[model samples]
Each structure stands twice: as structure tokens, then as C-alpha cells.
Target: MSTLLLLCNQKTVSDTLTDVLRSVGHTVIVAEDVFSLRTKTAKEDPDAVIIDLPYVDALFEDIKRMSPRLPVLCWMQES
Candidate 1:
């Protein structure tokens, strides 16, 4: 029963994962773009962050700086 911050730009990907995650009892908060990432991280203080995107090199550093202790899990899409 933990809250998870989900950062996904694709609508389909976000919707699918959000449903699955919620079914398992996790409270999922979503951020479609980088602009919302900072706000969500500060406001939600989620147990972990799930980045569902093809590229995350630019975001890894930002997430670390915001919440270094928080767990970050990346979900790479198949090509």
C-alpha cells in the first residue's frame, strides 16, 4: 500500500500501467511531462518513482537531486 509517482508521456502507456498499478493497491500519481515532475515529487513524496519512457538520461539527474533517497524504477518500452 505505497504511493508511486509515475512519469510517462504516452497516454496509452500511462493509462495501462496506472490501471495495473492501482489494481495491486498502489496509489499512483502521474506526471506527463518534466514540468510536473518537480511539483509531483515535492507534493506527493511517493514511495518510489516509475519512469516509463524511451529516454531518461536527462531526467535521472533531476530526480536524484529532488529525492535522492527515493527509489527510481525505469520501464523501457520495446522497439
Candidate 2:
């Protein structure tokens, strides 16, 4: 099973995604914001990351710097 870090502030979304991923036999870590996401990424060493936020270019760059081979999935919310 792969470990995925989900960076999302919305409780409902985070909870749903976590449940789905876990049901599929994947491990998931949820981070409520960029700071915690970064910290968790470094600490957990997840296989991939899913981000739902605005202005995520810098975060993507930072993740690449931390783990170049890491896969990232980004979703933007409608304002």
C-alpha cells in the first residue's frame, strides 16, 4: 500500500478522502494547511501527495525539492 499525504483544510473533504483511500488499502495522512503539510511530508515520507488549495505553485516546488520522485495531485476549489 502506498502512503498519501492529503493537504486539505475542509474537514468533510479530508474525512471522505481519507476513508476512500483507506478502504482501498492505501495509507493517508491529512494536513490542514501548507505548514503542516510540509512538515508531514518531510516526516512521513509518503509515496504521493494530494493538495487542494489556492496558490500552490510554491508548495509544489517545495515538495519537489524535498522528494523529487514524489507524485503530486492538485485540485483547485471554486471561489
Candidate 3:
């Protein structure tokens, strides 16, 4: 199983996803904001990440600089 870091501000969405991932055996760490996201990403060095936010372009670039090899899955809302 992989350690997955999840960055999502929406409480309901984050909670539901966390439960689902944990049930499947992956260790999921949640970060509700940018500061925590960077802190956890640097400290935890998760195998992958899931970004579910309204704006992710800048954050996505920032994360890449921190961990170029880390895989990212971005969740965008339909307009």
C-alpha cells in the first residue's frame, strides 16, 4: 500500500475520500490548506498526492518543485 497525501479544503469531500482510501488499505494524510500541504509533503514524502481544490495551478507547480517525482491527481469541479 502507498502513503497518499490529500490536499482538499472541503471537509465533506476530504472526509469521504479519506475513509474510502483507508478502507482500501492506503495511508491517507489530509491537508486542508497550503501551509500544511507543503509541510506534510516535505515531511511525509507520500508516494502520491491528490489535490482537490478550486485553484491548483500555482500549488501544483509549487509541489512539483518540491517533489518532481511525486505523482499528483488533481480533482477539478465542473463549471
Best by TM-score: 3
Off by over 4 Å in 3: none
Candidates arranged by TM-score, highest first: 3, 2, 1
Model 1 scores worst on lDDT over the 10 consecutive residues at: 52-61
Question: lDDT by residue for model 2 over 1-79, one digit each (tens)?
Answer: 9999998768888899999999999999889788999999999999999998786788999999999999999888786
TM-score between model 3 and native: 0.93
Once fitted onto the true fold, the runs of candidate 2 whose alpha carbons sit more than 4 angstroms away are none
Give the Cα-based TM-score of candidate 2 against the true structure. 0.91
Which of 1 and 2 is the better model by TM-score? Answer: 2
Inter-residue clash pairs, candidate 3: none
Scored against the true structure, residue 66 in model 2 reaches a CA lDDT of 94
What digit string (tens of lDDT, one per residue) describes model 1 on residues 1-79?
9999999878888999899999999999998688787789888899998897667866777888988999888867877
Instruction: Tell me each candidate's TM-score.
Output: 0.89, 0.91, 0.93
Our tally of clashes for model 3 stands at 0
How much is the lDDT of residue 68 in candidate 1?
91
